[model samples]
Target chain A: MIEVREDWCKGCNLCIERCPIDALEESDVLNRRGIRPPRLKKENECNYCRLCELICPDLAITVISDDPDEEEKKPVKKTLLTPVGGKIK
Target chain B: MVEIKTADELNKKFLREGMWPTIFCNGCGHGVVLEYTFWALEELGLDMDKVIFASGIGCSSRLPGYINADGLHTTHGRAIAFATGIKAADPDFHIIVFTGDGDCAGIGGNHFIHAARRNIDMTVIMINNFIYGMTGGQLAPTAPLGSVATTAPYGNIEHPFDICDLACALGANYVARWGVSHPYQPIKSIKEGLQKKGFSLLEFLAPCPTAYGRRNKLGDIKKHWAWYDDNTILIEDYEKIMTYGSEEEKEQVKDKIQLGVFQDIQKPGFFESYEKLVDRLKEKEAKTKEGKK
Candidate 1:
């Protein structure tokens, strides 16, 4: 599954232009930034190659793999170490 | 083992608090480059505790502040010099410099050349956005010849500096140029540069749609990015064409920028040689003490 953070998206359309299969297209819906962010228009044609995720200049795209076998690979979210708090695990 | 993480996860792990929603304009390539660097760091399973991000004044140089790691926001054109001090003080620290073309090639050209010549162990990820994006679109040293900028109202008459070529000529350990259009190659190259024991220069030709693009009539962000794809040629293909290709083919790529690994050589870094010299002198001193005894 491909998820896009709409708030972070700057409507660059780089992912749409760089997609090998043209699976992504600009959505008519306007984001808060008044820019048209891209959405996955052709799911079947999408290869999940993660090219859009890689090329998005805004870091707005995230490709979540749907493979059942890969379910155990969830990563623990890390917290930032505050200046005086020392290291946080 | 480091799991295969998504872009969101990478950001959560690497990006600092309150730094989200970066200051970069729409269609800026700096965030893409930052993502690639994060991917490289994850693949290598590096400890951020030991990594140091150094930068000078520019839009690209603003990158280090967003990373959740130790960083130095130094004076204009002095990122390399400050990074050198950090490396010398503690050679174990992995130093990565994020500098813009103006900061690296224009103001810091002297430091850049000497660092590459000495083969200092640091990774330099220079984002050449053509114009100085931060300072009202001034003509940068890496700006293409005849490119229009605020300073160059008509057209720039100065020849652009080839950063990767300069590094290769200085015999830097690793040197490569890639546009932000290509993601995989830059990730691989950034990883290689990080792992290499000496100076590595990975120059990225990125688009500045707001600053450079607006002034040069490349206002449309998509077309500005497509321009990179159209203007650059892979170094391997370039070599093949120059050798056996017809005149027409050769002429087509004459104005194109060559992108690929320009140099990769194994050589002892400056610190390594200096350590050896110290060891040799210490051995001589011990021998003299034994003779006196």
Candidate 2:
């Protein structure tokens, strides 16, 4: 699972536009007085394509998953938390 | 890393606050002009107090506002006029103008030609990014024929002005062309021009990544660099030409315009002659007054 630092996000939508899996849908809930946070509604169907992080202007979001479906792609060394020092632990 | 300094970081006396331009894209050509100007000034090592930076409207003109030196960011095409005034006001000061194709050739055409004709004692750095990178990349006086600009969607049919040839013919004492690709040459040229006595012009061919690069299919700054290597022919190494102007020099050059030092002749600068005329006037006034008394 990926955590979004809502306080830092300016809602640039660079991540929302580049997400290929369509797992991230923007939530209506506004944070810090009122900017909508990009909510992870379809986290179960994530592929962990890190294009969102590369395109984000504010460095707000990151995608993570344990199964790592995109293994054949570049070995993305993202610091995603895993279960008690388990795979990424 | 001594983090690359932004325009705001430069707190020199010449550049003014709230005037540093935020126009150029990341890794744009304007940076090269700024860096070169700084390098030239560092080489001159003049008293910082006696230096004036004049500029017209364009991305390049914004350079005058970035440095920590005395600056005058005048109206478009008026950099030369503004610089001329500064030079005339204080002949000891080193006056430099940083301008663009549109600012110098488009709006400031009359000032450009006349200043050169008068052989004004100043140094001009014309950053020719083909089209006007600012104000949305419109076609300019120096845009090469067939090159695509915002206004010239299809292609530019009009001929471009070769600044070196034009300035040389207009009585400018020194004129040279060097692109950002060969930044060192322009840097050296600027240093030399600052030391020289008469009007000197250095035309720098820079890449406009946002406007010209995108529209002309240049895609990235690297692609524009490649374009320079492929399209430009360096006039040095005189033997590289097919036909030289003369039979003897033809055997030497074959046929080509040499790049280094196109022209460096002893032309009388306006300031020197004007000062002499003033002295004559004062002398005549003294004689007349004495005779009347």
Candidate 3:
């Protein structure tokens, strides 16, 4: 499930531009900020990549998996690794 | 195993609930950087109680105030100095300094240099918006050549400081630069910076659409976001072009800023040396006392 907190969106449109599959689109209705926040236009087209969630500057978008069992799982803690250089491959 | 928490969960856990809808202007990159920090902190699973944030005066400095952790909103150009003191008092505490180009590279240039020189254990997340965003778009030290600003109405004639280059030269343990639009790299860099034992500098080329873009004719939010991807080149690509390419190809990337990890080396941090010095002096004092007895 995807949630777009209308009040929080500043209408950067970064999510719309960054959406890999064009799952999001500009909304016709304006939010409290007088800005047209992106809405989930093609929900089936969305792959749940969460790139929109990560790229949104306003922190307005959130993507949660539909499986209730997955939601119940506790946050996994990973050990820190020694600092290494280079770009992600 | 990876954490699958949503953005809402991370926000509720890390951000000050009252500070929602931050005072940032439309299309501001500061909030994006803050989100990256939250993601990095989450992935590392750091004890927030042991993490103390410090900031100098600027728009980016406002970041610490928004976070739910403890922090010091220090005077202009002194966040690194204050962070040094905090490090000296309690070496175990994780220090994260949030600063802007004007605050870190301009007003606090000396502090930044010395901190890196000493290899102080801290992560400096510098938001370089070219202009001083909060102060009516004044020309910052990091502003590129020919950029327009209130102070430089004609055009900026000054050559901008490549902060990552400066940090790498100063022997920082970790150094990387990324534009805010690139989501994952900044988060990974921030995480690496946190894990580093010595001074780490992460410079984010944030878009100041309101202050910088308006004056520079990049006011359109969409265009401004796209510009970062077009203007910057990966370090690997830059090197490949430089080493094995035609003159035309070389000239194409000559003006493009190189973005990637500039430096990462395992050097003993200042505290590690200080601890050794203290132990050595204590041993000498004990020997002298024994001889006297």
- Docking quality band of candidate 2, CAPRI definitions: incorrect
Better of 1 and 3 by TM-score: 3
Best prediction by DockQ: 3
In candidate 1, position B255 carries an lDDT of 82
What TM-score describes the B chain of model 3?
Answer: 0.98
Candidate 3 per-residue lDDT over residues B7-84, each given as its tens digit = 988888888978877889988899999999999999999989999999999999999988999999999999999999
Q: Which of 1 and 3 is ahead in lDDT?
A: 3
In candidate 2, stretches whose alpha carbon ends up further than 4 angstroms from where it belongs are A1-89, B1-22, B238-240, B244-259, B290-293
Expressed as tens digits, the lDDT of each residue in B7-78 for candidate 2 is 222223234435433346643656556666665666566667787889998889878666677889888899
Candidate 3 CAPRI category: acceptable
Look at candidate 3 and give me any clashing residue pairs.
Answer: none
Model 2 chain B: ten consecutive residues of lowest lDDT: B1-10
True contacts kept of each: 0.57, 0.00, 0.58
Residue B222, candidate 2: Cα error in Å is 1.0
Best by lDDT: 3
